[model samples]
Target: MLKRIGYTAGGFVLIGVLAVAILWGLSVGTVQFSLSQIFNIVMDQFSSPLAIDDPLNGPEQTIIWLLRMPRLLMAAIIGAGLAVSGVIMQAIVKNPLADPYILGISSGASLGATVAILFGIGVMFGENFVGIMAFIGAMAISFGVLFISNLGGRPNSVKLILGGLALSAVCSSFSSFVVYLADDKEGIQTITYWLMGSFAGAKWDMLPFIAVVVLVSIIFFWSQSRILNMMLLGDEVAITLGRDLHTYRQVYLIISSLIIGFVVYAAGMIGFVGLLIPHLVRMTIGTNHWTLIPFSALGGSIFLVIADGLCRCIIPHAELPIGILISLIGAPTFVYMLVRKNYGFGGE
Candidate 1:
């Protein structure tokens, strides 16, 4: 009972931190707003309808509602999604080093985005053709990994990892080849920026779809915590208990792939959140998925919001790519975790 109460209290604390992060994120861009002003704008926007000439519909409202809100929300969603994906991927592979992109999704998405940006290959898909192609490529590579791993026999973690590495190499080579052959400096710069990841393009119109997909996936995984725990004990143990983990592994992979695909589509290639957030949460709370999943989600949301806010203000009149900042911070933190004698996967 004490442990459960502590978890609940920790959860509330995380939510509070997330709320403060969101408010700070909304306030700290090129045009700063006081917390009180931000509060009034949000309340006014929600509490009453806007008239064309209403003072509330002026620049502050535009900045708060039309610009910053969606971007922050996107950050939260992507953070939660990636963190949860990490937990799932680690469990699936029974490896502490596993990440959401372990299935070659990142390489495949980069290849697709490279092609779309450099050659206009998927212009027919609409204004967001690049994102569309990325999603398709990620899914394709996930399926390819599954197929390759299953080629000789029933797939195991070793087979899955090998297959993913092979396909990732292939996709990366193709992306590089295309970039080298194109010789388009502008397109090259665009591809580089996209790969670094940002939520600058987030719009309210896009939020509903992405939010629904990510939220539903997180909930679904939480519901399968028992199976995830079983996976950690290995397939032999699972079978001895009258459950075959083969199908569950495949389903979880597919679901994780979908989460990652949308994340890449919405925010390009933010890294480290998937690889770092789960480890942080696991260290703090232990690895019972029931608590780990929700804590990681909230922790991730808070981390990304603060990171994004820092990215916006770290440079004068310029915003940093979120992916670069995360990599910079996550790498050192991860290394420290590794060197610590007390740290162990799933709390040992």
Candidate 2:
């Protein structure tokens, strides 16, 4: 009971931190707003219909509700999705080093974005053709990985990892080839920036779809916590217990692929969150997926919200790309975790 209470307290603390981070994200940026002003603006949304048009702070309301809120929400959603996906990937492959992009999803998305941006492919899909094509590419590569892995025998962890790596290499080569052939300098710069990642394009219109997808995926994975735990014990143990885990692994991969695809479509290629956030949660809480999933979700949201806020104000009149900033932080933090003798990545 005491342990449960402790976990509950930790959860509340994480949620509190996430809430504060959201508020901070709203208040930062070029046109800053005081906390009180932010409060009034938020309250105005729930005020009487007559007062709706006349906000407490009109300009601030527009800035917060229209611009910052959507971006911050996207950050939170993407962060949660990536973190949960990481947990699932690690469990699926039973490898501590595995991440959401281990299946070449990133490479596929990059290739799709590269094609759409440079060659104008998928333009018929609409204004967001780049993201759409990227999603398609990600899904295609995920299926391709599965197909390759299933060749000649039932797919296993080793086969899956090898398949992913091979497809990743192939997709990367194709993306590079496209870049080499395309002479559009502006397009190349756009690809570079998109690959680096940013929430600058986040809007209210795109949030609903991405948020629903991510939320549903997280819930699904959390529901399968028991099976995920068994996966760590290997196929032999799982079979002895009458749980195959083969189908479960594939299903998890497909679901995680959806999460990654939409994430890439919405926010470009933000890395390190999927790789770092799960491990951080594991280090804090025990590796039980029941605890790990929710905690990792909250932790990821907090990290990205704070990161996005810093990105807005880290330099005057210029916003930093979120992916670059996260990599800068994640790389060093990960190294520290690696060197720590006590941190056995949940193996101990």
Q: CA lDDT, every prediction? A: 0.92, 0.91
In the range 131-197, model 2's lDDT, one tens digit per residue, is 9999999999999999998999999999999999999999999999999999789999999999998
- Candidate 1, residues 15-77, lDDT tens digits: the string is 999998999999997999999999998898789857545664789898888889999999999
Please name the candidate that would achieve the greatest lDDT relative to the true structure: 1
- Model 1 gets an lDDT of 0.92
Model 2 alpha-carbon miss at residue 52, Å: 12
How high is each candidate's TM-score? Answer: 0.97, 0.96
**Over all chains combined, what TM-score does candidate 1 have?**
0.97
Clashing pairs in 1: none
